[model samples]
Target: MNKKGESKLTIVITVFAILIILVLSFLFYYYAVKSMSFSRSETASLSGYADNAGRKESAGLRTNVIIFKPSEVLPQQQKEGYCFSTSVADPFRQDAFRCQVENEIFDPCFTTEEQGIVFCQINPLAPEAFLIKLEKPLPKASLLEFTQDNWAWFVKLEDKTYCSPFTGTRPFFSQDQIAYYGCKSNNIEEQIVLIGDLMIDDIWTANKAVLIKEKDNWAIKFLEQIKIDSVWQ
Candidate 1:
């Protein structure tokens, strides 16, 4: 009722309001961060990988990428017999990829595009080199064998075409083969929207994430590190 009492009451109310604001701000930030983390997946939608169930195929399987720079190596990159990584979680399984190795993986990146993907293309003869889903265990090759001629998939690594319909999971299938999967909207027959082979569209990642390049620049790169984070049934 007194002046001093009134002043004290106002101060307390002001302090309570400030506290509420601080609390609300913290809550807002916490929720925002949590949502973002959940949204983040350790996957990038690649050309063949897709979010649709019917589109799921061996093309979506996770593969490691390896890149060799021509400036770094003369000629091209060579592949030896192959090495298998033994870190696979299911040690008991006879078919485990635990033993890190290299081989059998024909094209590390999909040569075809999925339903909704965009891509950046490299010269089939891109001086820079790259590999997909590689393990350190791959056999070592001599420098003399490093030319485009020595590439394992050189048979299909030409720039003549960018994408084709996917028939099956033939590791050796070329972009032309991936064409079957597209339609009037996609028919090279329809628009022949042939840009530079540098841009790959309708990209999908192993985790079903779809993505498009922010720019039209093409660069070849191998995966940095491969860690077995989780297993799928």
Candidate 2:
């Protein structure tokens, strides 16, 4: 073939190769996002499924026992670096496990001015059903009291009953207006629970995030909503 024809052929080949690369890149990104979203939806649905399966033994009580795993956040004075590592003990099963918190997880929910501490209550039987206290109390007003079904408990937010049937008989305030509860009907293996900010937004929203561990790393659904912002606005 002549030099002109050969050069034209080379140019065509180069363009075709570039197009192939672009198409492959796009597909890879699309599938990765789709897989992450599916995982998050599955986790949220499982949480609901566990709740529905519970059988009530007595009035407002259940035969399925879901114990609260109580965890406390270290004080600001104790923060060593940008990341914090802590261990929690399961009160019922008497087992212990370690959880790590780094900039990727911490920066979303807390601000530089506010002290970021998490008191996590992880269940020994079902580690996924847990509670987190991630706020500093503000000076507001006095505590109020109310009674329902012959059970008396102090109300911190609004005078409303029934946070959850599993979160004890009474629902108490965590920080200011935050109310949290937990219910455990099933145990999930190889799951990572994240509590706090799930997105990088100016609005401070928190959620109870559940992620499944894939291989050595955790597969966080980058596109899907981790957990709804439980922060009461």
* Stretches of candidate 1 exceeding 4 Å from the true structure: 42-233
lDDT of each: 0.30, 0.33
Question: Per-residue lDDT for 22-78 in model 1, tens only?
Answer: 999999999999877766642433322555544575445433222322232223333
115-171: candidate 2 lDDT, tens digit per residue = 443332221222332222333332222222431221111111111211121222322
- Return model 1's CA RMSD, one decimal: 22.5
Listed in order, each prediction's TM-score against the native is 0.22, 0.25
Which candidate gets the maximum TM-score versus the true structure? 2
Off by over 4 Å in 2: 52-233
